[model samples]
Target chain A: MLSIPIEYYLILSAFMFIVGVTGVLIRRNAIVVFMCIELMLNAANLSLVAFSSYHGNPVGQIFVFFVMTVAAAEATVGLAIIIAIFRNKLTVNVDEINIFKW
Target chain B: MNIELILFIILATIAAVTSILVITRSNAVISAVFLVLNFFALAGLYLLLNAQFISVVQIIVYAGAIMVLFLFVIMLLRTDGEPRIFSDKRYIKYFALLISIFVFIQVSYLLLIGSPSKSVTGNQSASINSGTIETIGKELYTNYIIPFEVAGFLLLAATIGAIILAKKKFE
Candidate 1:
């Protein structure tokens, strides 16, 4: 079986992160952007897990667990805020919900 | 190409295609499902790297729980079908693509230029050979206990916050 090197995982992470950056930049919907942010986080998590496995220590994997937990929390709080904003503004575009500019 | 490289390419293609579908499709439901495909592809890649625990977690947490939440929100908010044209930042779109290409080039350069380094101690794929779940459990409880507990607390706070945020205002 062909096994990919650790570097390949890093490269994949880089690609996914870039895709996520573009998703955030191009998309108008705040929800899609938020999901893209999650994608970026997951890309980094993939790299961390790969590194930990390559090094045979559980530290990177442990850190990834922490990252996942944080991501979940972020998703919850973020979605809640989005919902609140949507209820108020009647739209979820990043360009429109600028009430906190003061 | 060799089997490993071939498999990597296949998986990479799948992930890339699904991710593009996720981002480009106007329908929120289709996009969410494509994101699930992307996650599953990533989990497969993780398995290739021998991070079995991480792979399973990726499938369970991301593909299972998180996406379910996204679907729930999308349906609850009635945000299906084509997304509306909210922004006209055409210049920023081009800029983002250019930057992504630059980053991809830089990473490819590094990968091509980098030398193969040997593994560190206790990680030579020989020193400690065990299943991913067992090894991760031993390490998480023994060495990384504090962070684990902190993460748990963080999740609890987030759960409460989400409930507070999403609850209907039925006065």
Candidate 2:
């Protein structure tokens, strides 16, 4: 067995996903949290590629490409929304962004 | 332990730690920069997994394009310094902490309780070592035509949506 099992990569991805989740939850800054979400997405991508490699399949690798493209689009839209929020409230705190909060 | 295994562990730890820093740090710019570092480490992990195309694209799209745009917007907005972001929401910090712990537990359980046996040989590909960008390009345009087109359409919509949202206030 390779010292690093495929499971190891899976575990690493899981840890990263947890960390990203924590970052999203703990950070009040919208940008920080936004980056955290990106972190989570990348974690998922890492596992997908790792699993694909372990399986010796090209499908998962291709899926990673799709995920990357979507991530790019999501980041663009998300950052633009952040910009709009900044314009309206002059702040990027999720708490202060109570314009629509019920 | 093999070199790849050791390197993965070290890099994974670094990525996780820096990601924590990226979120906990008060400075928005610093957080953004750390996110870039996190992406680079992820790309490195992708490299170790033998997903050369994914790794290159990870760097190009994430570390290069997306992160630069994020930094640009953050800097352009001038919201780097603290100016009363979540000062009033005192409970939010605790709430976030709880959520993170919950997620960690959930994922740990799923991993532990799920299948421990590794599958033998369902993933062997004839073109693994030899297939390059040329093959990927051909496959993307051929067998993966529908999903590829759908992804392109999604990008177009996201682009239009972003432009509309960003330009709405001015008009």
TM-score of chain A of 1: 0.93
Global local distance difference test of model 1: 0.76
Tens-place lDDT per residue, model 1, B1-171, is 687687788888888788777777777777788899999999888777667787899899989988888877777675534444334456777788898889888877886677333332224463134327887798888888888888888888888878877677634
Task: Report the C-alpha lDDT of model 2 over B70-102, residue by residue, as the tens digit.
Answer: 888878876656534356367776787788778
TM-score of 2: 0.87
Estimate, for each residue in A12-63, the C-alpha lDDT of model 1 and write its tens digit: 7878887888788788777888888988898888778666766666678768
What is the iRMSD in Å for candidate 2? Answer: 2.9
Best by lDDT: 2
- Give the residue spans of candidate 2 off by over 4 A: A1-3, B80-92, B113-117, B120-127, B130-135, B168-171
